[model samples]
Target: MAKIVASSPGKGILHGEHAVVYGKSAVAMSVDLRTRTTVEPINKNVVELHLPDLQTSSEWFIEDIMRIPVTSNEEIEDAVKVSEALKHLQTVLNVQVPCCTDAKQQSIYAFLFLYIEISRKYRGGNFPSVKVTVTSELPMGAGLGSSAAFAVSLSAAFLAFYGKLDKKTPLSQENLDEISRFAFQAEIIIHGKPSGIDNSICTYGGALIFQAGKIKEFLPEVPPLKILLVNTRIPRNTRDLVASVRQRFDTCPAVIQPVLDAIDAISRQSWQLLKEMSNTNSLQKFIPLLKVKFQENILHLLKESLEQAELEIFEAELGCNG
Candidate 1:
């Protein structure tokens, strides 16, 4: 088999950040940046993983790792380090696959999931000892979906390695869906509640308009939306944000329900506007509407997670009219 080298782009949602989890639609764009993974075979029974971007590496004999039990209670860090799928491959193949370790936050788990899935599917002879390298230029965790990008790149690399990238023929829609589905499965190991948007956008680049249960990549449509992202170095926990929103629903339903309803409406309208832009070629006309609806929806969601004092600060930051 030929060595596989694959790369996939980073993605960001223009609307429906957290609200999408509650079955809202969101528009997302694939940036011209990516994570890359390269796989090369060696002569031995030990595979190695190297990640130079993060300046970290770890490796274990394939046989030694297989004996390690898979435990969900052993903390996310440790469980990911010694993934269940990796152990399965090690034990079944009865070989050593040493992983070169890296600090690329998501690389290890992505590699483990893809390796095991491929091994299970082929069920052929021993997989040659290989050297795998993951490298990326995108910021690791700035909410840019770097984790999903890395996972997709690794999955694509393995698909190419096994000569399965073109197994279904001329890039049909079904083939695209299959590729994206496979990538999404690998991403689950890294992102506990992935929306699947990241994996889909990275796997099939360009502009995507995604609904609660569907995703569509629009054709050559370049909208005039001047997207701006605000990063709060405040480092809010997503779980805590969700919990706070739930608490509002439980404790102050009368006050919060209207806001949530309005936000949901905004998300729906935004999705329609994006779809319209894709069809009409009049993207400039909807730019202002897109900006207003997107900002309003996100601002309301943020309010659910903010303290009164923090809300005051946020209002001031957005200025008087905003």
Candidate 2:
């Protein structure tokens, strides 16, 4: 088979950055850039893996692949497991595929997981050793959808290389859906909890409104919503962010409830406007309401009255810069 190489973009939350981690609805996107992977088949039973961006590479004996851990409760562990699984497949097929050394240890794991999982279900083969390389334009951990994008890219690469990807046929929709589901699962392996919005957006490559627990209903396109993401310049861990919110729920429930409720209201209104607003005229009419709700609701939740300047900066950063 020809060398399989693929790429997918990372993403960030526009409004629901932390909220979605707690099963709440929020908006997120596939940013302008991504992580990529390449799978090449070699002649021997040894797999070489390289990740250019991270500057890491490693080789594994295909027969000894099952030694890598596959079960994990966290993203890091999940990533290693994926790597092990890929080695297992290489051994199973008795084919030597050189994996990239450049990807993060965890990203390599995730790549292996996607490749093996997707391959097991759709196609089986034996081949010579090959080289795989991954590159990306996105930052490693900026709350972007780096992990999901990488997973999607791997899935796409495997499907394309196997000649199993059929975008033109309606029967392929089932395969596409199944592939997306597996990709999301792989992401959960990389991210402790993912809203699946990033994968969906990267998978479809456009704008979407994501609602918690509403898979089919929540994913709707909003062409007129002028979306932009502003990083807080502060690197926030998904785990820590979720934990803080959880702590608030446990120790400060009364104080936290209103914030969540108000944010929820904003999300709802935003979705409504996204559906209703079409042309520039409609967008201009809706902009003020959108801005006001976002500012007021986020301000109240942030308890910014404590820091007027902090609140102003927050609003200015998130606000439309004209």
Candidate 3:
């Protein structure tokens, strides 16, 4: 039983959040904050989970987990399959089905979901008894990719424990892809309709442009930018916010579609500016244009809906002097 440890960075949506749900382009970048998972083999025939961020710890007997019917990775392909699997786990664990309403429960479900899936996939019918511990520097439910980072780290740890990962060197592209795929499955269990951008950025790190379920990582020439991640301590329900946006789109597609299109344009422009900035040293020259475009296209659209203080806080978070 090898002791395996892995960590993955959280991510922030640089541009295009709700619009991405409508097949529009978006950009996400990996933040310095990370979630780390460490797996150690135990002599007992039980698997333990310790999550400091959630302030919970539990252990499941390997025999009990093995008693549950195992689904092949191919069988659990889509969200429906993932949901079905989650339902089965809920029955086995005697927990609530829709556990997302509780942060601690949701985090536990995600861990169990990933642990069962990855361990089953790699270790076959023989489940290993391991004590897995996780700790994170990321803020919970801040629209950052905390869940994705957790999933990625767990996937990597499980893979490493099964001797499927390279022990000597950095994870290769192939390894990253596999980790991302597993993390995406976990995301589906949590988010229901994740775009895969969060998992991709967490696995590969740096920045990426994602659109319509496709992701393109930033080129090496593009230097990573230092960013300030300020937690406003403001809490909002993502489902409610998404529903509100969907309602607006449903009611006025003619008007809202153009706003979404403008947002998409801004994202594309920002992407291009990033590329140009990578090639040249004069990054400041594009800041004004980018600011103007953001103000005109995005801020203008969001102005009426967001409170003045909230808007000001966001602007300040973006490092806007105005």
Candidate 4:
């Protein structure tokens, strides 16, 4: 039996949160927390999925998945077909049909979606019998890109299982791109309209600056930073937050637009500082000066853009600046 293991890192937005939605630049970096997927071939013609984080385990015979009669040359070609396949898988597994709010069901659906599509794409419509176990260190629905990490890991593992991966050396750029593409497809199942940055950062394993839906690696040659991920244990709805921001922008463009532009400027400056940090041989010597300048500029911009009441409210609520 062949065994393959692949892992991908979670991500967080360094800057440009709400502004990124409005065609602005955002910086996102992969965190240390990751998700790992293990694929082991089984003698019996069955595909089993074990997602411990979701407290779900399911198995289905390859013959059963094939009997559903859904085929496409490409995995992402037909959304309706994929939905139908998900429904069929849900029925076969005796699981509830997935809704947008149901994270557990959605996760299971994503796993089965990738499993069937990837197997069909690479194995020539012959579903391989394998047991996939996914484990993660990241928390779900925390704006931490946990789902993206899971998707990337699953994509890489399935590709490796299908003999598409080169195990002798480091993964090539082409390999990473393919993995990112598949992961992005899976992400669409979880996030209705994803910006593609999370999967890209997870696949590339570094900092990335995403602008207007385009992604460029940030200091790829430089090693990843040791980031501290402090989970507030707050469960916030991303869609609702985004919608609220949009509504605010629509309601008070004069006020919100300036704040967004100020944030964009701060993010751009931070990106420049990151570039300088990468270039400087003695980061320890330069970081102190850079920090002071960054804070001064950010404060100046925020004060200029926001009203006194707004600034006080922000400081009181966020507790970042006293």
Candidate 5:
């Protein structure tokens, strides 16, 4: 009917960033930064997209998107799989892959998938006309959950537009969960099978423990800590980042698997420490917490070093600033 706007928080992975992709538990906390999306009906019979951060804009006739095809999860074809759907949409949209980075392509693909599939499911295949615009306070591709926040906000906005979400009760658990669910689906297209922690943090605006595609919410026990979020401004595709970690693990499972287990242990222990710190002034558990933090810190340093090796190869391929 009228214009709808929704926003979702960005997140910081306190522990288990790379390990989480391997189905290890991670702790994700919502950050101050967020992404906002607006969806409004248009009479032009076209679906328009505006991604200001990406400096990109496009529009598609509803007729064209509908003709691209739709199917249920159980009945999906190779092209319908979330991983392949973007390429399929790309061929249909006639968007040149050479002109866009993998990050940019995936961002556009996630949006288009959500718009087309969510609209089809919620508003029926009648091809509703709408314009969707996205604006973000988070730095793009800096690994601050910017993509997850974007997806969550886009999902919320589209759901609200199609009468699947309540504008007045956007904060309701039901609405938040629905937004998170759809955002995770979009995450699959972008991250190639995310752990669902980022979208959960963005949707619920709190701390979460996510593993094996299931997320558990934890109370915000401790006060917010002051920390700086550095945006290196180095353009890197998240999928590439994840793939690097996967490649390392795949190559050295004997050595790397234990490291991932250690990381998971660190996350679980830190989560417990947060809960303990929230309660009594007991210093007994504090030492263990410090130890866990120290261990995780070491792991993080190792991860960066490993990633640097991979990045050097990319630098040689794409120049310092591709």
Candidate 6:
């Protein structure tokens, strides 16, 4: 039995949060933390999943999985049809996962879906018993895109194990694109409508600008940026947050629209400044870049640009506008 292992980096959004949902541009970079997954085909009759970070393990008998309704690839390709397919898949399977939480359940669902989909095309439904093990250095739900990394690594590992992609050429643009495509499908199962920033950055492993469905690769090589991360250890649902933003826009598009526009401008300006300042690989350039930022007050302009709209809104409400 062959074993395939793959790892993908998490992402941190530098600019554009709720705004990116509105088709505005956002900037994100791959973080140091990554999610790793290993897939091993086994002679046993059960499919297994082990998540070391969560201390979780579960298995489903191949007999039970085969009983689930089969949907053709064409049907699964449609979002609505696949969503319904999962509901059926969830109902047909009674696998009780130890340490089962909402997040774990979601991840499991995504894995099962991707596995069946890819396996159907690769091995023609002559399913084999497989064990998947996953580990992650990124904190879940800390806004660092733990799920995206999971989806990316899992998709890549499965593809490699099935010989759809050459593991040696994982860095090639063609391979990255295919890996990212499967990852995005898994993301839809996890997060209702992902901005694609996390999966793109995780697959590409560099800085990027994402807008709507388009991605502009910012840096071919990962830049050496020293960043500090702090987790508040609070539980927040990404779906709820996205829903709230959508609700806000529906209620007051005029207000939220300008804010989204401002954020897009900020993201664009940031990329421009970073490109202009550090066009070369010289370490000496960074010191001058930092100096120019503070000395010229470019940071001040960005801060004021974001806040100015709120200030104007309040002033207009109170008849303080001149």
Candidate no. 3 TM-score: 0.87
Best by lDDT: 3
Model 1 root mean square deviation, Cα atoms:
7.6
lDDT of 3 by residue, 1-322 (tens): 7798899988888788877878888877778788999999889989999988778899998877886776645754667667777878877777787555566766677788778888777777688888999999988778888889988999999888888887666678889889998888887766767778888889888677888877854653335455566788798645456666776666556656766777788888888877777787777787776667657555735324333435545777788654
Model 6 residue 292 distance off true place after TM-score fit, in angstroms: 10
Candidate 5 residue spans exceeding 4 A from truth = 73-80, 87-91, 95-100, 167-170, 220-222, 280-295, 299-322
Q: For residues 188-307, write the lDDT of model 4, one tens digit per residue.
A: 677655667778888887677887766854657543345566788888655455565666566557776766676677677777777877876767765665566446545644324444
lDDT of 6 by residue, 1-322 (tens): 5898899999988777656777988878788798999999887899999987767888988877777777755635545645765766777885433122377777888888778767776787766799999999999888999989999999888888887776464367788887888788788777777778888999988788889966964676545666677799998767667775676566556766766776787777666655654576774666565445334333433334345555656778789644
Tell me how many clashing residue pairs each candidate has: 7, 27, 0, 0, 0, 0
Worst 10 residues of 6 by lDDT: 294-303
User: Residue pairs in steric clash, candidate 5?
Assistant: none
Q: Model 4 Cα RMSD, Å? A: 5.9
Please tell me which model should have the higher TM-score, number 4 or number 6. Answer: 6
lDDT of 6 at 67: 77
| TM accuracy, model 5 | 0.84
lDDT (0-100) at residue 82 of candidate 2? Answer: 48
- Which candidate gets the maximum TM-score versus the true structure? 3
Clashes of 5: 0
* Cα-based TM-score, every candidate: 0.73, 0.72, 0.87, 0.80, 0.84, 0.83
Q: Tens digit of lDDT per residue, candidate 1, span 1-322? A: 6688888888877666655655656667887678899988777667688878768675656665444444333234433534555556456545444332222434565566567555545534335467888888777656677767777787777767777677553446665665676576665555545567777778777777665646744534545556666666664433344555556556555555466556657766776787687677666778788779867866776465435435655677789667
How many clashes does the backbone of model 2 have? Answer: 27
- CA RMSD per model (angstroms): 7.6, 8.7, 6.8, 5.9, 5.8, 4.8
**Residue 170 of candidate 1: its Cα lDDT?**
41
lDDT of 4 at 69: 54
Pick the winner on TM-score between candidates 2 and 5: 5
Off by over 4 Å in 2: 66-103, 124-128, 167-172, 216-228, 279-282, 300-322
* Stretches of candidate 6 exceeding 4 Å from the true structure: 72-78, 94-101, 281-322
Residue 283 local lDDT, model 5: 56
